[model samples]
Target chain A: MKAVKVILVLFLLSILVIGQSYAGTIKIGAVLAVTGPASFLGAPEAKTLEMLVAEANSKGGIKGNKLELIVKDTGGNPEKAISFAKQLIEEDKVFAIVGPSTSGETMKIKNIAEEAKTILLSCAAAEVIVNPMAKYVFKTPQNDSFAVIKIFEQMKKMGISKVGVVSSNTGFGKAGKEQIEKLAKDHGITILLSEVYDKAASDLTAEVTKLKANNVQAVINWSIEPAQAIVLKNAKQIGLNVPMFQSHGFGNIGYVKAAGPAAEGVIFPAGRLLVAETLADNNPQKGVLLQYKKDYEAKFKEEVSTFGGHGYDAFIILKAAIEKAGADKEKVRDAIEGIKNLVGTAGIFNFSDKDHNGLDINAFEMLTVKDGKFIVLK
Target chain B: MNTQLFFQYFVAGVTYGAIYAIVAIGFNIIYNTTGIINFAQGEFVMLGAMTAVTLNNFIPLPVAIILAVIITIIIGALIEILFIRWLVSPSVLRMIIITIGLSIVIREVALHIWGDGIYALPYFTGTALKTLSVGGVFISPQILWVLGICSITVIILNLYFKYTLMGRKMRACASNRSAARLCGINAKNMVTLSFMLSAGIGAIAGCIVSPITYVQYDSGTPLAIKGFTVAIFGGLGNSMAAVVAGLILGILESFSIWLMPTAFKDVISISILLFILFVKPSGIFGNKEALNLKEF
Candidate 1:
């Protein structure tokens, strides 16, 4: 009995020490694909959150407490994400969590977030992640359906009727193609062909040949950058003179550089233009963009891509929402949902009850590659 | 929907099958010599592909390929000496777990160094994609490359094993490490050599693939699994059989794409492997009684 008491006293003393050392910080846990193929998204999400947290503290923090971001890398795997979410919740005692940058990874942790009543702001853009609608869950990232909707609007404006969409057989690609097909019909666009590429595909000529024979005016590419670029190169090689309509993903200059001159006239609905001249002065978010651009460019010492813009947006939205909520969990959730006309590096992000995504069609500034640089379409 | 479509899918499957076969060869070679199934072998493909792309961005294709291979060979050897050398005598399960953990670490390190974003790599020569029509079924140059590489790798590896003294010593080390040590052969070097060779092959696979399919950091794991499965089905330690096994999986998956949804392709392969394990534990080309739980 005496030994048990002595042990209990030591445990209490250790707890006191731990509590004393790290206290008064509003902890927000984040899960990102920090070490996988999707690290492209997670790295930015992680970096953006840090910048936002630092900036928030510099301005006296949210309601006088510093914002602490506890982050984990999901590595683009869904199974690993569930465990990491649990770790952040139980071990870290975080106030809320953000993460699992891909839709596939985000889907794995949705139930855990619901059971824990922890607010999860997912970065993946898959429509199915939140289709069933979990409470305490919202996404700042755009979904496939919205992307398709944005692309459909552009297709309608381009006056192109006959369309061909080639997508990978993965869940994300299939869903996008399905939504594009449904929206294409609603938008009065004729579907010329629908093709599928193997996930392990290196060449796509056999698939492209069928699409090429269809006499489509434009091709909607719905695959990751590598396969998508393969399609563009092969299509151009086969002398298919159709305009290619790409998803927001093709906005990366790396894709353009990979496709070389063949990527010219390829139109995509970009979430943000990292180096657009328009955002420097006259744009509404000029101040924010200017600050973010200055910091990001200085750190990485390379030109920022649209992905960096996403990083800038994720962190800013969280900081602003936290400030408005004054550290109250319910209030912060409310603040995030109630965010109206909140200017971000991406654009003026306005969120409401009906819409979870803050950005709209206007946010997707249409752009094309001209002379190796993105020429913003008027 | 028709026979022509069937033929198209079949041809597609054959092309894929060939690539997996080449991937499997690396698995077979490493397993044959080391008795340790290195999971990061797939990362060699990622590394190789990424390296080729990095090099190709600045230099010519031939030079890029050469540089990619050399870098991968060095990486493979270093990984063996650094990580696998200590785990050489552990249980196969431990080795497998260690390799998977190492793979995770490798992928994370890759992610940190190379930020996420899908990169598009062009096929050889940065040339226009060319297709051949054989008997009304269309085949692309990429398929030809995949098939050509696998064939050459199989023949060369088989010849080396049969002819070269170093290759014979490798076989000896794989078969009887104690005996090989008694014969004054550097058994440790043999293990490292196997890793280097496997890495070179994996690099070639990656280089050819990135230009064809597009690679990301996480893409290596699935390919690694597929490669392991092909080696197992064909005979885990049989390099030549790995080639056949890779092709078999590719063609089977290609046909299955038409018969079933592509999402369950891995499931189908898993089921097939399970059946094979239950009925024929020795695999296609392996010894029936070689199932002893032994050390490297």
Candidate 2:
């Protein structure tokens, strides 16, 4: 009886302490695919968001109001996520929204966020998620166009002239094609052959052999997971090994492990800022990002990959907006749009009235798999 | 277009084709002997590769592979006796569902035990990059192993089916279960034998290719589908045709990608399957003069 009373007293006291820290509570909603095929991303994203929120609350909360995280599962479906976003804004009345991963899914709810005048901080890497001028959408991930352009830059340095590109016929892949086409003339690179594979399509041999026949010097892949590995193996089997490259999304341990020996020498453009020890001295988002990296590694029990770091930055950006606007949805929207030189894990966010990505072209980092890990060469 | 690279691609394609052919042969054996399809055949590959990883910690690669095959064969037989026997019926849909369910259970169990991380099995010689040059094309040792192991399997299987009494019983069971049973043959044991053969063949494939592609918890589905596709393309139960079809498909796929973009490669393979369905209708070596020639 005595022990029970003592334990009850401690629990009550802790709750009181927690309550006192967040006297002005701010509700922040996050949507991710917590279950299903893409749960790998959702599981990690949810954990990271909760940790950041807890840390912020412990440190007197964000601007004296504790961040309340309301997370829901989308199961990696885009249509279902639009409903989740609507409910989060209307029923939950969250001041800011965090995620619902992948560009394809994010694009589904972009218009909804805009109509509701909700500030949606998307972590998906599709360029169009922030394009076509959505006032409320700001992306934390590097759009596929930027990633492909980075690859093209590296290809120029390698003296590559012509390349065949294979992209998933999804929102992100289309964006990559747009970027690659725009840069073709500048780099003196010609698009020899282009092929589109649906997400569920497997056994990609005929298309790969066709690319080889077209006399393409290089192959660029813009997809994720087992499919990417399949492409590499098929290309190698057909003797089309002219220094193949992939997008940043393919830089996970899953791709490397599945590709086995095929993964060697495959180059791709990953967000290199995550790999650097620190951003430059004048880099706006350096200090917060360094602290984020330290705290994330300590909490997650894993290395701070770009995904986790992206989550951390997105959280910070949302928190800063809420603090500036006193958790008012309309004011938060204005603050996010008007931001200038706000330091983040990826790079400085210099969002203006016209450009919402806030990225510097200098932030590009080209990488290749070396001994079963991504090594940034550019 | 180059002679050496063409040779390289040819050898590599045939080598991969051999692996798929053996997997298809295993599928055909179980399907023909028993009136069921084991979608979990890929899990046998996962099991074999994972077993090699564990055994290779203590034993040599060859010993590990042999042990993996033996254990998988036993497991294959046990699963048939315990689960598949009860589930087998005249309803084809039910059998397919049961096999799919078994595959899920096997996959989840493997994932629970091993987690989702990919494991790299060491190559037999620890020399994956060192290639055998013929003319101008380079061939890796993995290709050679896939070819040599598959050839040995085909020869042994040919001999077993042609000369051995047990093999004759298996063929009898496969051709007609009721007739084989009425003729005093133990159809149940023959069914078990088919599973044993399949699991062992799949294990062999896993052992040969694990050092090349490695293995993960969910690596079974695509391999199963490819093997199934190959089996279907060959006339379902025809082992020789399956091998030939696998090689043809592999080579055609490898060379066909040279004419299209690499992304649309899957569509091309699927299109060929559709084309075969329309033109040949009964597959490459299908049994003729039969009204309803069911394929596994």
In the range B1-296, model 2's lDDT, one tens digit per residue, is: 76655665566467557667767877777776665677888889888888878788899878988998999899888888887676544466776787788888888788767655556466666454455556655566676777777777777887888899999899888777778989999888887788899999888888777655557777777677778888878867667778888888777666655554445445656777788788875568876643164434
Compute DockQ for each candidate against the true complex. 0.26, 0.30
Q: Once model 1 is optimally superposed onto the true structure by TM-score, how far is the C-alpha of residue A284 displaced, in angstroms?
A: 3.3
Highest DockQ, which number? 2
Tens-place lDDT per residue, model 1, A1-378, is 999999999999999889746656888898987655666677767877777788778988777888888888877788889998999888886788887788887788888988888888887777665566776777766556667877777878889888988888776677788888888878888887777766655555556556655678889988764677778876775557788988777767777776777777888777555445654366676576667777776776766666656656666677778777776777887788898998775567888776666767666667777877777665
What TM-score does chain B alone reach in each candidate, compared with the true chain B?
Answer: 0.93, 0.93
Candidate 1's DockQ is 0.26
- Clashes per model (N, Cα, C within 3 A): 6, 14
How many Å off is the CA of A253 in candidate 1? 2.8
Kindly list the interface RMSD, in angstroms, of each predicted candidate in the order they appear.
4.4, 4.7
Candidate 1 clashing pairs? A37-B218, A40-B116, A201-B213, A202-B212, A202-B213, B17-B250
Per-residue lDDT, model 1, residue A149, is 76
**Best of the candidates, TM-score:** 2
